[model samples]
Target: MIENVPEKAPEPITGPSVVVLDKQVPTVSDVQQEEARRQTKMDAAVAFAREKSDRVRKLAASQQSPFQGNSTGKVIIPNTKVGQGYDLFAPVDKKKMKVLFDWLKLDPDAFINILRLQYHKNPHHFRSGRIYFLDHVFSRIWRDKYPEFKSSEPDHNGCKKKAPWRGVDDIYAPVNFKNTHWIAIWILIPKKHIVIWDSIAKHISDEELAEVMEPDQWIIPYLLVECAGSGELCVQYTLKPFTYMRVTAGVSQCRAGDCGVFTLMYIECHALGMSFSPAFSSRNVKAIREKMAVDIFQEAPESHDKENNDNDENVTTYEQ
Candidate 1:
């Protein structure tokens, strides 16, 4: 019945076959699906970080405020009126406090003055006036010389103006470089070092930062000399060379908008002579922001109380 070939295997029945290749090429759909998965993972990670940050903020906000008295939570600084420029004693309304809420950017009034108040509160912890947080406008004055401080004048007029830098060991000045980023310029007068604290230092070149500070190196020393000569800038002025360096170590922010907060923290840590606490990272920044707002809002009256606490060794008046 069967030939030598046997009954031909019923002609091999096959539909459109998947020709298996050693390596299959990915289709556009495959690529798209893979990309979508990657994106979803990233979104999930970001959401988790944000959730953790929010929890920390809420917990800290619920704790008892260190400040005494029923917190009005109204005026940040009483008596002094707002819109009088960036005065250290200027009044800040609730709206300014709102900026410290929800990761909002801090204006000079909100941060610098709050810091001044905090430092002013615990004077025994820090040497009064030894650490000066200059107004953000200090940079502007440095760039566009004030008429009173014009180079042509050669002197601040023998009238003996107040030199805030008098007896200051560290000057934490916020420099808004190019109107884009906020950075801290820490001038250690004794160390003769101009240390830069920037959240995005890695993204910038040492050369660029040095260039931006070149003018300051000369102007600052000159100003110090001028003040020491005229006003109460009592630090030992050696006129020696000052070294400029950018801080590349420590916790840095993962986002761009956090530079303002980071700058404030840098000043705080350095002023306290403490290394950046683990609590000062990007995850805790929201908490830091909330605490700052609370400290500012509640401590509005602390300035007056501080002035009255002259006999209390734990507190001392910040004399300019």
Candidate 2:
């Protein structure tokens, strides 16, 4: 075997052996294209579902609705029931009244005027006259109300500066004689603005009014007087720490007139920290209140007729 054995045949390479070492790398572009396709399919499904839902909702609303296309051309009016018997002057207890007076820091005359306005048989008669008197009263009360907060004090540099704790001085009263259903009063404070709403012929409690103010903070005393037959009155302070101010009644029905007194008051308070001066004179305020009242009462019949016609149109359109 050693002498003449044939050379062993080289074993042939068998089965699957690792010959070329090609790295099994995944292409990023291919993965991204696949993902993009999946996302596109998902988006299409979502859009289709949304369209189907909207169509179903529209169909359901069409079958059951009464005023589908009448919103643009009609003045809708709410029906008032005869003799629903709402009390215009709801009596307040002495304790509640006292709390209100303390909260507002009102003087005796101002307090009396508030009471008189609340109890008056005809609020419009006192609208102009009382507002002037109240303006003077408010000026005096505001001077006395914020003595500590308004006073200058020595700061870290030994120079006098206005105290950091300040209260809002702007007050707004929006009386709508034309719309005697409700009255709104606005008070702008350094920290926030408050709105008080009272039913024209109803009484609102002090507790309810307090709810309109920010909680857990010192609130500057303010008063809201609502004469259902006249207008709403608010006594507030100005940016000048101790200055008293007032805003007259505003009518919301007119597009130009609906400046959203409440919204403006809030914005001003938020931006400037609750201090503002009166923008209108007392006489102007009174005049506006009187004019609005006359307009409201005189327009009642026409308003009712317009409402009826609008309703008829709406019903007809919906039926069609």
Predicted structure with the largest TM-score when compared to the true one: 1
Clash count per candidate: 0, 10
| Candidate 2 lDDT, 1-320, residue by residue in tens | 45886789889978887766456765789789989999999999999997765552223333444756444222232123358597779685779654543322221233223323332545354322222211222323333343443354534433232222222243443333222222334444432444443322223244533432222112232111111112232333222222222222331122222222222222223233333334422334334333433433344323222233322423332221
Residue 10 local lDDT, model 2: 89
Candidate 1, run of 10 with poorest lDDT: 311-320
TM-score of each: 0.54, 0.18
Q: Mind sharing the TM-score for model 2? A: 0.18
lDDT of each candidate versus the true structure: 0.64, 0.35
Estimate candidate 1's alpha-carbon lDDT, on a 0 to 1 scale.
0.64
Model 1 lDDT tens row, 76-178: 3243335957669868677866644633354543566666777887866654467777756556656654334433433343322233334667878787777
Winning candidate number (lDDT): 1
After TM-score superposition, the amount by which residue 93's alpha carbon in candidate 1 deviates from its true location, in angstroms, is 18
Residue 75's lDDT within candidate 1 is 37
